[model samples]
Target: MRSGTDVAYDDVNELIATATRLMQKDAAPDTLTPDDVRKIGEELDIPARYVDQALEALARRREEQAREAQVQERHARLRRVRLRRSAWVGAAVLGLLAVSGLVVRNGLTSTLSDVARQRAQVRNVVERRESLRARQDTLTPGLSRDAELSGADNRVAIEQRRYDERAADYNASAASFPTGWVVRLTGLPHVLPLSSEVSTW
Candidate 1:
């Protein structure tokens, strides 16, 4: 003979097992009528009132589980969106940096090229003046003072002065703020002072 406690325990186990089987069968909560509860109670040999209460409790538990699953799914979707946004932001930042680097590189290259061309012009002028001096030395002293020679000397002097002024202006601009940063970063050489002889001429 089963004691009252054993009988109650058996009834509770039967209720849990039957509820689990119904849930596994995908029983819809709304479809579980009072007749279904009565049938479960008869099968489990438990009272209809207890079965009805258990069915209601099980339905609430299933609803709560469904709500929790939805919440978890929403959180997962939110995390994926955040991760995608982060990736886009990171790519944008890198692209900006790459473009900025290219701009800086191109600017520095152009500036240096201009400076080199200017320096070549200055060298050519200096060489021309040296060639003229050598020719003057080969001539008689009177011929050196001829109108043509004097005019050539004057023109060379004017050209040398103009070159010096231009060079000085360029150096000043490069040494100033903004441009100076580019100059320093590129390691550009500073313009040299004009020869003292050019000033006297």
Candidate 2:
């Protein structure tokens, strides 16, 4: 809103100050046409050629600003697309890695379980042989034959052989490539191919 056009000002400076403050809030930000530029130049004693050069420079600046905005928009669109695809691809890769990790973990667990079982069998056979030998030793060899003791010795040997084979397999797996990493991560027990300690009865 304007103070009435008919209002009197104390001086030109006062009028200019009021107009400046009003323009700060009330300007429409419209661009000047060629006619407006010429009229302004004529009033301000500016040359027509200078006005033409100013218009040409303004046009070039506007073109540059428009191009910069387009480039920025294109980059933004590319980033959005990459982010969207990365979400899907990342999820799929993670799913595959999870499945693979589980498989390796289960495999190691199963092999170690077998090694533990076979170790128990070997121990049981050795204990049984020792007990039979003790019983046979208590009885005079002349009275009872070596049949039970022989059988116990054979069983102990067979079970020991089986346990050795199972331990060997476990050791091989633990030393293998990706499964080795899995074993390390899962804290799986390490098994040697065979034990050197001997039990004799």
Candidate 3:
């Protein structure tokens, strides 16, 4: 029977007053009844039907809230699964890198060792040649021209030349191979050792 605007303003005032009283008491929504809504509507000059509509709207809002909470729970579970998978993948990658590093380190150490051994053999050959030359010089005046020491000196020189050739070949092969490929391919256990290790000639 009242004007729409007057009814609306009165309804708003009544709703505000009820809300303030409920807040002071910390009243739960379950305690709110249709009779309480109807009483507020009557005081506001509002129709009883509108009060029922407001209660239905509140119920729909509660249902929407429940659906949103369920969605958030599913999203949190999916995030946890993705994080665990990423952690495992990261660990596997780190392990592979560590194993590769060890293989490369061992290969370099072995190659350097072989080179050291070859150098030592070359030094031995040189020392033997020098010793033979000294003996030949000491015996030149006392022994005949066709002395056994002269023949021994020739054999020592030949041995020295053979060692020299091997050293030269080793140096050449090392030069031909690039450092990157050497590390990558030679890191494997089955791959043959450097060229110098297998051949004497």
Candidate closest to the true structure, highest lDDT: 2
lDDT, each prediction: 0.69, 0.81, 0.64
| Model 1 error, position 142 (Å) | 12
The C-alpha stretches of model 3 lying farther than 4 A from their native spots are 1-23, 26-30, 139-201
lDDT of 3 by residue, 1-201 (tens): 446644566588887898899897885465757898899899999999998898899999999999999999989999999999999999998887667556655655555565556656655665665676676676646566345556656664565455555545444444444434445555432233333464431
RMSD of each: 10.5, 6.1, 11.4
Query: What is the overall TM-score of model 2 with all chains considered together?
Result: 0.69
Sorted by lDDT (best first), the order is: 2, 1, 3
Residue 98 displacement in candidate 1 (angstroms): 2.9
TM-score of every prediction relative to native? 0.50, 0.69, 0.51
RMSD of 3: 11.4
Candidate 3 or 2, higher TM-score = 2
Q: Is candidate 2 or candidate 3 better by lDDT?
A: 2
- Report the error of model 1 at residue 178, Å: 14
How far off is residue 69 in model 1, in Å?
1.5
Where's the lowest-lDDT run of ten residues in candidate 1?
A: 192-201
Structure candidate 2, residue pairs in collision: none
Error of 1 at 11 (Å): 36
